[model samples]
Target: MVSQSAFAFICCLSLLLTFAHCKTLKRDVKALNEIKASLGWRVVFAWVGDDPCGDGDLPPWSGVTCSSQGDYRVVTELELYAVSIVGPFPTAVTNLLDLTRLDLHNNKLTCPIPTEIGRLKRLRTLNLRWNKLQDVIPPEIGELKRLTNLYLSFNNFKWEIPKELANLPELRYLYLHENRFTGKIPAELGNLPNLRHLDVSNNHLVGTIRELIRVEGSFPSLRNLYLNNNYLTGGIPAQLANLTNLEILYLSYNKLSGTIPSGLVHISKLTYLYLTNTSKALGLMERARLSLFKHFPYQAEYHLVPYLGRPLLRTNHSATLPHLTSSRPNMWRFSLWRFFTR
Candidate 1:
């Protein structure tokens, strides 16, 4: 049996250890409070406590995810997707240096992303899609060396796509479509070695696709590339056929003018191709026509037909074609069949 003084001392030490191991770091708690206050009264009701990290099993707050780091807990993820969060980007998030993912998509968040976002060096995914956020993307996003996925689509963002994004060495998926961006597509984007999917469609981008082609070994691992609904001119680069892993290509609704490249037929993995409303001068070369039929003899047929007061060449491959139709005249629609697979 222990003396009263020794028993009391043991109890006190156990209580101290419990309190130390259960509480979130003071800085992280402060940041969480600031984020809640910045988000106005629409924040989650569970955000009511001084200990947002809870008792180490789950976070007390709804959107916050915390992890243990020695004696304290730290915020690691904040996924408030489609929560109707109103107001600007929460600037306090930069304080969470250990954050690996930040998703605030499908909100009413407005204004430009703060440059302090670069402070989250451990971030691997940053998704801000389907928001009202406007203004040019900050170049500091390039500082996230571990970023693998970036989705900024369906926003009101304007101006040129930042070329600094090329600095992200591990980036894989880059989606900037359905925005109001203007200026030339950054050719530096083509040099991303690990990039798999790139979509810049439905913007005001101008200039030729030749810049991307000039970079040797561009888009080596690319599988899906979307450059539709822009003001791009010049011929389609035949070097695009070099993307052996490419499965889908969208270059429609642009001002491109040139004959279709016959080498595209050699891309055996290409399952879907779109070239609608490209230009009035765009046509399929005779070699390209023969190549298409050679690869897809049963389903591929090219012929000119009168439609919408213009002659249009349509290729029908019903087996693999999606239910897509274009009313615009002077367009070439090719529904290539995935007849061969690698």
Candidate 2:
């Protein structure tokens, strides 16, 4: 049998090895820091310091989820959309390696989206909406074969939708709204068999919305269709009626003047119909908005947003406004999952 001193030495070695491994992950975080730093996105993501992963028996970090067993390697999902963080996206994000979802919306972040983002092989949902982002979307983004939902709305993007985006076999929700994109919606989008929500609203998109609608089968999963506020001409395709699952339709504020398709208004699941600037009606002023917001009872995953620059709703205006137009509180959010599978 080993002497007690020898046993203690072995234990010390094992502890040292474990500590070294944990420190390695810190290197990964620092790599991310560098990427986020240069791009200015570190400003929005700076809350990383507030993370409580080291707390005993608990790990609470906003927009982050972790695996339940073993060392609990980060099967992380970062959903910080509309969190008001600003700055550029960095190549270091691909370093997270285990990340499945990344949502960064409504921040003031500016710069070209790095092509390296496509290197995130495990990524699932990627939403970068309502930021000041400008530049061409990298065709390399198609490399995200596992990608499901992709939102790139309200930025200053000006490029043809890459034909490669259709290669994302798992793609479901695709939003390219309110940008400067100027091109025909590629017929290849129809190749995305699992596509559900397709919104290309408020862009400079031109030409007929294409004939892929006649492909003889319904995109059973397809739901909301938002093609509003564009220069797209030509009649609304009757083939659109075949999509039995079609729901919200926003065709207002476009050059398309054809009669509304007969079955459209009556689609069984169709709800929250929006038209020219109708969604702008959803922005309620301060007191009125806060009234709808019940204080979050438990600890929040994300830090509380400051009142400064937060949208305020006027109580008087809310009373007069049509309640039908308002969005559900934090409609873009999904439930937090405590148990993650790696």
Q: Where is model 1 poorest over a 10-residue stretch in terms of lDDT?
A: 333-342
Q: Which candidate is the best by TM-score?
A: 1
- Candidate 1, superposed: residue stretches over 4 Å from native: 1-20, 55-59, 284-292, 295-342
> Against the true structure, what is each candidate's TM-score?
0.82, 0.63
lDDT of 1 at 111: 93
Ten contiguous residues with the weakest lDDT in model 2: 333-342
Candidate 2 local lDDT, 5-118, one digit each (tens): 999999999864553344224534555445445644544343344222333333334455544324443536666566566567655677677678887777776887888887
